[model samples]
Target chain A: MQVRKIMCACGSGLGSSLMVEMNIQDVLKKMGVEGVEVVHSTTSDVHPGAADLFVVGRDLADFIKDVDKDEIIVLQNIVDKGELEEKLRAKLEA
Target chain B: MAGMAEMLKRENVQIVEGVDSWEESVRVAVQPLVDQGYVEARYIDGIISNAKEFGPYFVICPDLALLHARPDQGVLKRQLAVTVLRRPVRFKEEGPDVRVLVTLAATDADGHIEVMRRLATMFCDPDNITKIAEANTADEVYAFFTAPIE
Candidate 1:
């Protein structure tokens, strides 16, 4: 997988998911990792093969394990750019 | 992007010293918006239910939680309510302890995108969180996000 598409998710899909999406985009841009598309989603809307990567909270990590496909990343603070930068670095590099 | 000061109104911003629980905090924080007819009664129910099902997904940072419900659930408008609690409220035992709750309602998927974008940037600043926590009045809270978006 090329990891071209990323989907961020929270409980309701409206608030925090979008927050994560924007932060992820920021990291990708700062890292100069281009051509990657990031989107927002909810726990119920996620499934296997929907995207190259899935970003979610650790609490909801189990529910999406079936679809994680070895690319489900969990974060303590979704809006913290430092943490996001560190985590996304490994994936974007991989 | 719309900053938090503009996204939230003075009437909707609250400074409560104490709250019973995290769940109650969300309910109480969103009360103003509910009273103002910006959100429906079930919007509260939806936010609580979603939190229960998925844990505290909105605990975006160490001291903040952005409360929300799905647009299809019961949202009638794009509005935000800020409630600052003197004591920290923990949505889940393992989740980040939050001192402020910003209840939000969006009429459509993209209605609140700009506000959320601005908030994501705000959440990146650790210093801003401290300033927000020290704010004593709703107007003070409104002033915290008045700066132009970066």
Candidate 2:
């Protein structure tokens, strides 16, 4: 499996984004998926070069308009850890 | 009554103290949310069950223990940080323990400091904390969170 770089972006890139990153990592591990690199970024710093996929929170969804809709993932709430993991895994495989 | 601080002061709110373990702390923190109709009682049970399966400790701090908890739910992880703020550093003798944790999802220290300052102004009254610790019902706890400190 290729180690794809995943960036979790949010308004401040500190609290919520980090939470999502941790959740994603946990889900991947539980599912026995490996070689995925997870990172965190602020909305302003998110660029195509930094990562292959951008996991964004609902509050910052508008900021990523320039990015391809297929490349960006918007989350209203990050509570369902399983759903998020599944979504990311599907994206990675696709 | 809708302000964050005001909503936190309701009378039914109880600030439980001596939450040594993560399970104990979560139970005390979610009680008011269930009692005040903010969250369903079943949800509270679910959180507890999840915590038990994944390991306790959801409060997000600089500490690595938070990461060790392996929270499967993103909302639950966020809630852990928020719950930390709701947990009372101290509990009153008369009422239920404080159940609400207000977390600042700020990334930098500056944001955390700013939110803390605002929270202090809103919920830092000596009387408010005192009365909050003594509150019995969820209504009383809600009053404490909502009431303006004199």
Clashes of each: 0, 41
Relative to the real complex, the DockQ score for model 2 comes to 0.04
Candidate 2 residue-wise lDDT, A10-82, digit = tens? 5445445666777777778887878889876567678766777888755467667677777887764443465
State fnat for each of the candidate structures: 0.83, 0.06
Model 1: per-residue Cα lDDT over B63-111, one tens digit each? 8888888888777767888888888888877756778788888776566
Error of 1 at B12 (Å): 0.5
Lowest summed lDDT window (length 10), candidate 1 chain B: B1-10
Distance from true location, Cα of B133 in model 2, Å: 15
**lDDT of candidate 1 over A1-94, digit per residue (tens):** 4788998887877778888898888788888889998999887878887788898877677778578556878887777778878888877677
Estimate every model's Cα lDDT from 0 to 1. 0.80, 0.49
What lDDT is obtained when candidate 2 is compared to the true structure?
0.49
